[model samples]
Target: MTDYGHDLLFGTFTTPSAQGAQHVLDLAVTADRAGLDLVTFQDHPYQPAFLDTWTLLAYVAARTERIRVSGNVLSLPLRPPAVLARAAASLDVLSGGRFELGLGAGAFWDGVAAMGGRRLTPGQGVEALREAITIIRDVWDTEAVGGVRQDGRYYQVVGARRGPRPAHDIDIWVGSYRPRMLALTGAMADGWLPTIEYLPRGVASLPGLNARIDEAAEAAGRSPRDVRRLMNFMNVSFSPDDDGLLAGPPARWVEQLADLALTHGVTAFFIGGDDAGAIERYAAEVAPAVREIVSRERGHYGSMP
Candidate 1:
């Protein structure tokens, strides 16, 4: 078992479709009212059918009360790090410290190029993201003596004035899967956010992937637990019988999630769907159950002689 000893968090992941704008807001409110810890929306700036993720996030933050809001993973290629940092800080302050950043290295190069973002190879994308993280953090470091200055291959910031620190220390969660991205996540990011469905070998891929992050963290002189593990469940269902993964009943979900926490050290769970009922059930039933089970297991292990 590989418990990270972090508190378990449950949340919803809703699509930011322009056609379903009101519905998306309703889902965020539902998750908030249902007591979910966080609510996230997919970010695809190139998608004409989707609302701007950052704008939608601001609106949703105003509409919701307690639930935290974030992009499932904001596309970094289209968002300049300095401006993105200030915007994030502004939203974090506006939301009363209820904002977290889930960011990604750019995907869909053709669409990015069409949208006026420079196309980058996968390796370059990783390096660019690393540089972006540095710039973003520098922009957030208002306590620093001088303005932010970084001359990097991908981003160049010359003495950029930093102000408007966030209301809270907003965690930067990176949506990463590959080796370089995973390593970067461990070395620099606060959390790892990866969709389970996208894993090459499904859940079985986690151990090796997490090992990569763990090794990277260790090599970087950081503890592996420094990076919290978060998973997005895109293919979830509340069925009567057993299907697979998170497709079973709420009890099954609770069990599976508790096991994930105890065995794999996944501390956060985001259910990706627009179903209000599922959100409610996940909040009302599965979340508490998973937390209780994991807490009990941790206590039991701690008491072992």
Candidate 2:
């Protein structure tokens, strides 16, 4: 058995294009074959630029095993809680419980407007996110609480029941950029997955984000260790020369990630498949190294593999 958190795991985030779905599924099989831990798809609707992430992931899930699947970050605000919960629960059950839910306060204003909905202000969206999560969780656990209730603001759930719970409780990861978002993530999410734009680069920026997360978790009376820290990183290929990928060389990457696990309480890292050639390259050059890395981390983190 391998510890899910200890392993320096890597995966892909394919663009939500119909033409890409088949490729995405193919890549998923590739990840499983290559022994990678997870894969994710981004969610959006009627963009005319991407495929429906949930549908695509469902497609991929049907054809593979071992590899965990997730939404890079589902736009929770655009969806009604009961419907969304059912969708995720269905996926969870159908996929043999290998599902992760990545939730984000929808921010694509134009897309929202196009859907005949107004864009939510930052504050408004966050509040909406809060309500949305609560509603979904409630529906999954009980039959008479799946409807809507309001607290003088945002969409509220009344008195509806949500039954037929998912086979397993799915892990939830929240996306964040601002302090408030990060704070919320620390308090409520099972994990944190940040875009590359916000992940720390210099020595200074990194510590602050880590500190805030710890502070928030502590204040909330949750152990910082319970929440995972993950970086949404792009897999940049080197000519066997460049500084390697951000997670570092295969073995070093595992070591570095373990250090981060100890420091920031991170257990997962989402690797995006950017270059068209990354799949082949990782399969050939990076995959074997990672297998060994996981074996090492297994000695320390306990096994979920």
Candidate 3:
């Protein structure tokens, strides 16, 4: 087992379909009440059929009491880093620190260009993401002697005032897979966010990718533990018997996910589903069972694990 020894977290990913706004909100509330650790939504600024993610997040923060809210991966190319940092901090403060920043180097080039966002090449996207992280973190540094100053090829912030500090330390989780992005996550981000279905080789690819992150972390003088690992199960199918990855009943999910926690050290697993009852099933049934099993087998999690 890899056993990075991080605490386990459970969450739900809801699509921001404009027609299903109330249903989405209700599902988020259900997840929060069911003791899920987080409630995340995708952010696609150029999508006309979707509700604005930031607006929905603010409403969710006001409605839910404890569930940490975030973009499954907010498109950084469309959001100015300084303003995004301030918005995140404001929400974090307002929600009593129940917030995390899940970011992505831009995707959907056509949609992005339609919205007046630059359609960056893959390399430029990665570099821009790095620069954005720098700008955002600097903007959040209330203790810095001087203000934020990041003059990068893609983004440049000159002496921007840092204020409206977050209620607690906010985490920047990057959704990345390539080598450069993985290294960036290790050196700078607090967590690595990747969807299981999109992985080139599923969990089979984790060891190599994680090794890259670890090496980069060590190179940057940061412990590998500094980068938490979070994965989301996209398009799950629940049934009464074992089928496949997140495709079976609660027990099957618990067993498979617990294995992931023990073997790969992926502490957080977010389910991409919109059905409220199924969300409850995942939150109340699958999540707790996985936690209990991992805690028992891992030891350091104690009884609560």
Candidate 4:
């Protein structure tokens, strides 16, 4: 078992549809009112059908009272790291520390190039993301003696001033899947956020992938537990029959998620959908049950002297 002992978190992953602007906002408000921990939106800057994620996040932050907001995984190619760090901090401050950064090394190369962003190879993208993370942290280090300075191959910040400290220490969650990216997450990121559908071998792939991350973290002189495991389920159904991983009833979901927490150390779960009713059911039933079960199991293990 790989329980990291972090508190469980449940969230909604909704599409930021430009056409259904009001509906998008309503879903965020619903997640908030239903007591979900986080409300995230997919970020596809080149997609004209979607609202600008950063703008939507700021708006959602202002609209909701308590729920945290973030891009499901913001495309890093279009967003400059220095500016992104400052923007993240400013939003966190404005939102009363209710902002988490979910970043991605760019995917969809054609769209990225269409928008004047660099079209990098897979290896190059990982290197760029590494540099970007360093620059972002330096920018957030407001108490540091001097301005941020990183003459990286992909990015260069020649003594840029860092200020407007975030209201809280913001966690940078990286959406990663490949070996190098997973290693990067283990070495640098605060959390690992990967969508279930993207995994090559589904749930079975986690242990091997997680081993790579753990090895990288150990090599980086950080504990494996330092990286919080977060997973996103894109196809979830609150139905009666046991269809698949997350396609069964809430009780089955509770069982499956509890197992994930105990066996894989996934402390956070994000359900992807736009259904308000499903979100409500998940928040009311699945989340609490999973938390209860995980807590009990952890207590049992903790007491084993």
Candidate 5:
């Protein structure tokens, strides 16, 4: 068995509105009080119901002292690498090392194009994301490199410098839904946030996909074990009487989650919902049971020290 931190990588997401922001912050306080590990907010510039990820993370960071804050996955093409690098570093400094960065090349062509970002072909987007990660890491490096420039095919940075380098390395999670993106994440990221669920289709394809990732990492001279594997389940709930309920009761839902972890290799799960009552049910009933199960599975108990 692999040694791990708090196993139930539980977190929250918010719709981007004034009311949604307040609702999310309230959940942050609740998640913190309940001993959750991280809270994440998503980004969308064109949506009428969106809030700024960096600004909101900064606010959440200032308000909570113990819980970590993150973006579920920020759109990399939307900002210049230097600007994003500095913003992430500043947030990391303010949060005392509790900031995690999740990035993706981004979908929603209409939204990004509206803001002057050209659409990227799949290959171009992946290249851009790879370059973004490289630049961000160099900027966050406390030790200087021989050169301060990144000359990737899709992105370039010259004399790019910033920081008050993060107090600790910022954990970077890249969202990926395809083989190419998965291999890219394996080559460059700290974690893999798979878009697919842990169903039979995913299970059947795992070995081949993971082998490809292994090949890519080996080609890059990186160990496959260096990266963490994470999964996301949108709209999860527990139902004591009905497992069919997409949003069910607590005990039933927690059991499904435990099974997912034991049978599959799901180390982390990020859950999403639009209703307050659903989130409350998750935090109050489902979260505690899942945490207990994970602790027992690890042969350890109590909160992380």
Candidate 6:
């Protein structure tokens, strides 16, 4: 069985538009009211057209009662792990534990460099991310009264006071596509976040990719299931004749998402699109059907001798 025993989650990926911030904010509230599990926005700090993700996240948290808010994958290059830890924990506290942290090493290096952030090669980026993960987790340990300390090639913290813990354990989901990044996710992160767009080989490549993560997790002396597998689909269509991924109606989406859980062990799904109607359809229809299918499959698998 490909089931990994992780609870199912349904979320929407909404854009943070500078011109349409209110519209974007409304959609987040709508998703929350519709009973969606998460409301995430893309982070592009240097993009003039995008609203600041963190600010938007905070506003959405205040505007909505439930629904987790986050940067789809925060730009770690621009957001220092030390300060970011406090910000995240504060948001978690204010939002009543309704926040999850999704991170990316860095993208658009030229843009990042222009914004006074260091440019990093792929290898360096992985190392920096590993260090950032360690530092962030350490800073969140309110039980420990000591300051955070870490010396690394890419990132380091010395005698940095730790506290203001999150209301709940915030899962750090890393959006990775390369092998080194996947290994880091397995070793350190609570979840692995990737998109179908970045996966050139499609769903067929999931097994091999998962194997790499598993190997890394085992090597780190952690259970492979310690890390959740989360993926995003760029778009879904309601065309029954279309055999493309996430295409067709609610029934089709159910089958597709269920297959990911039952075959690929992916438990969290972030539906990509800004359309309020699509979000409603996903939350109102596809999510329930997928949950039911996975539940039945889990029951059958558990009953097996």
lDDT of the candidates, in the order given: 0.92, 0.68, 0.89, 0.92, 0.71, 0.89
lDDT of 3 by residue, 1-305 (tens): 57678889999988988998898899999999988999999999999889999999999999999899999899988898899999999999999999999999988999999999998998999999888988888878898888888878988888889977899899999999999899999999999999998899998989888899989999999988888999998789789777789998888888899988888879999988788888888887888889788988977643211
- Which pairs in model 4 have colliding backbones? none
Candidate 6 residue lDDT tens string, 1-305 = 46678989999888799999889988998899899999988898999999999999999999999899888899999999999999999999999999999999999999999999999999999999989988999999978867899998978898999968999999999999889999998999899999887897989889989989988998999988888999888776666575778788778788889999989999999877788888888889899999999999888775112
Global Cα RMSD, each model: 1.5, 4.2, 2.2, 1.4, 3.9, 1.6
TM-scores for all predictions: 0.98, 0.83, 0.96, 0.98, 0.85, 0.97
lDDT of 5 at 142: 59
**Candidate 5: where is the Cα deviation over 4 Å?**
1-7, 145-147, 196-211, 244-246, 274-281, 295-305
Candidate 2 structure quality by residue, lDDT tens digits, 1-305: 11325445567766666766566667778777766667887778747678877778888888888888888888776666668888888888888888888888887788877887658888877777777777777767854533545453676566656755787878778888778887887788877777764555632355677677778988999876656767665554334333644544444544554444444445565666544456555555555555565556556665432
Q: Of 2 and 5, which scores higher on TM-score? A: 5
Q: Which candidate, 4 or 6, has the higher lDDT?
A: 4
Off by over 4 Å in 1: 303-305
Q: Candidate 1 on 51-104: residue-level lDDT in tens?
A: 999999999999989989989899999999999999999999999999999999
Q: Is candidate 4 or candidate 6 better by TM-score?
A: 4
Instruction: State the lDDT of candidate 4 residue by residue for 1-305, as single tens digits.
Output: 77777889999989899999999999999999999999998889999999999999999999999999888899999999999999999999999999999999989999999999999999999999999999999998999999999999999999999967999999999999999999999999999999999999988998998898899998999988888899999988888899999898889999999998888888899998789999999999888899888888887885111
lDDT of 5 by residue, 22-66 (tens): 777777777666666777777776565677777788988898978
**How well does candidate 6 score on lDDT at residue 4?**
72
RMSD of 3: 2.2
Residue 264 C-alpha lDDT in model 5:
48
Q: State, as a TM-score between 0 and 1, how close model 1 is to the true structure.
A: 0.98
* Residue 198 displacement in candidate 3 (angstroms): 0.4
